[model samples]
Target: MRVAIVGAGLMGAQIGCEYALGGHEVRLHARDLRRAQQRVDEGFALVDRHALFTADEVRAAAARVSTAADPGDAASGADLLVESLPEDLELKTAVLRAALAEAPEAHVATNTSSLSIAAIGEAIGSPERTVGTHYLNPPLLMPPVEVIGGERTAPETVELARKTLIALGKLPVVVRRDVPGFVWNRLQFALVRECAWLVEHGVASAEDVDVVMREGLARRWRRVGPLRAVALGGIDTWNRSGRGIVPDLSNARELPDLATVAITEGNVSDDAGARDAALARELREERALGAAR
Candidate 1:
């Protein structure tokens, strides 16, 4: 398959490398061609470090990716067009419009984390081909891609998105509705909100919250979902125990002060980034082994 990725930022570069590694030809488009190409090279290096493919295979995959001068150039003769611009509706729609004009028949997908796919479709005026393929962060490593269909998105387009993601060896969950944030972000933010509130209210420090997730919930939730885990623990028990906690859970409409402070501080831990990448690689290897079995 020929893929046209309209953005060569971090996500776009990783996504293009992902498609290339999946044995598809990828064309990347961005205003800053040099920076985009450099990022793509870095993406390829990251892929190599992850050990997703052999050295020879990595070289072959790298060869399959090329940078285009513009959206039209990238989209020319493409089978799929992926827009990974920032979360600006106007910017995305404009690029999509330009790219779609070049490849009118190609399937349209947006890597929007929170934006409404239907609104984007409306803006592009091609709802039939427009769908959301919300990939998780570190796109190349993350397996789950939320496939969302807008109001006017054709059923076939949704199916195409599913099939394409599956072809890339990624898990695709088809969202029935085009709700904002879809499924993943909705669940994610709920936990984040509660975490923020906990930290802000002196219930637990931020590091303690991380420890709870890393040591407790994540260990169990990794294999079993919350619902299933509850079922396993006896639904009646959960209903009796969790019912009281529901009312106390954070429901604040505004962002918590702690969260705001953290954002303002921008105190990112470089070690956490390194650890996350290492863990992602480890999980990918495990998944590959499981698939082989």
Candidate 2:
């Protein structure tokens, strides 16, 4: 298999390296060549230090991965095309349109976390070939890659993406629709919204909130989903109990003032840039460890 990945940043490089390790030829494209090379170098370093493969295997994978000299050249002869561009809808759409224009026969995928897959596919004018392939961060080790089908996405295209993820040893979930944030973020953000409200309303401090989620809710939800947790004649109880709280749940149309103040007070791990990186790394490490088990 030949794979072309746009955006050779952290996520892109990790995903490309995974394909290379899976015996697929991978070409990573970037607007900035120096940055792309730096990421590729980091990928090789990770391959060398990784516990999953031998020196010989890492060398083989390194040989299979390469950076494209020009961005346009990346999609020239690819079997699968991946867009891991910035979160901006316009930027992602433009890149996908140009890349898909050059590789009409290639299966197209966007690693978008929130943007609507159907909207992006409409912008690309190739919805049938395009599907959302949201690779969770630390793509090299993460197991789940949320897969969503656009309004016009063909069933075969979705299956091709599933097969592609499986080939790379990834767990892929077929999202029922091309909704924003797909399945994961929808559930995740719903929890986050309430967590914020709980903090603001003085119900719990941040750390205690963490304790409750970590020791109680997460411990249970980690194994059985919420619906499954209530499956054994508990649905009636849930329905009766849930209705009372449903109206009182957080319904903020914008970010809570407390959230803004937390960040303003240096709460992204303590500030925006470093905090985000640290949190992302921690989550990635946790997911990687869980996947290993």
Cα error of candidate 2 at position 74, Å: 1.1
User: Over 4 Å off in model 2, which ranges?
Assistant: 44-50, 257-293
Clashing pairs in 2: 266-270, 269-275
lDDT: worst 10-residue window of model 1: 258-267
lDDT of candidate 1 vs native?
A: 0.88
Each candidate's root-mean-square deviation in Å?
A: 2.0, 4.3
The reply for model 1, stretches above 4 Å from the true place, is 257-269
- Tens digit per residue, CA lDDT, model 1, 1-293: 89999988999999998999889999999999999989999888877776777899889999999998789999999999999999999999899899989998888899999999999988988888899999998787778999999999999999999998898889899999888789999998888888888888889878788889878999889889898998899989999988888888889886765544243334467765686687677767777898999
The C-alpha TM-scores of every prediction are 0.94, 0.84
Q: Pick by lDDT: which candidate is best? A: 1
**How many clashing pairs per prediction, in order?**
0, 2
- CA-lDDT, candidates in order: 0.88, 0.80
For candidate 2, give the lDDT: 0.80
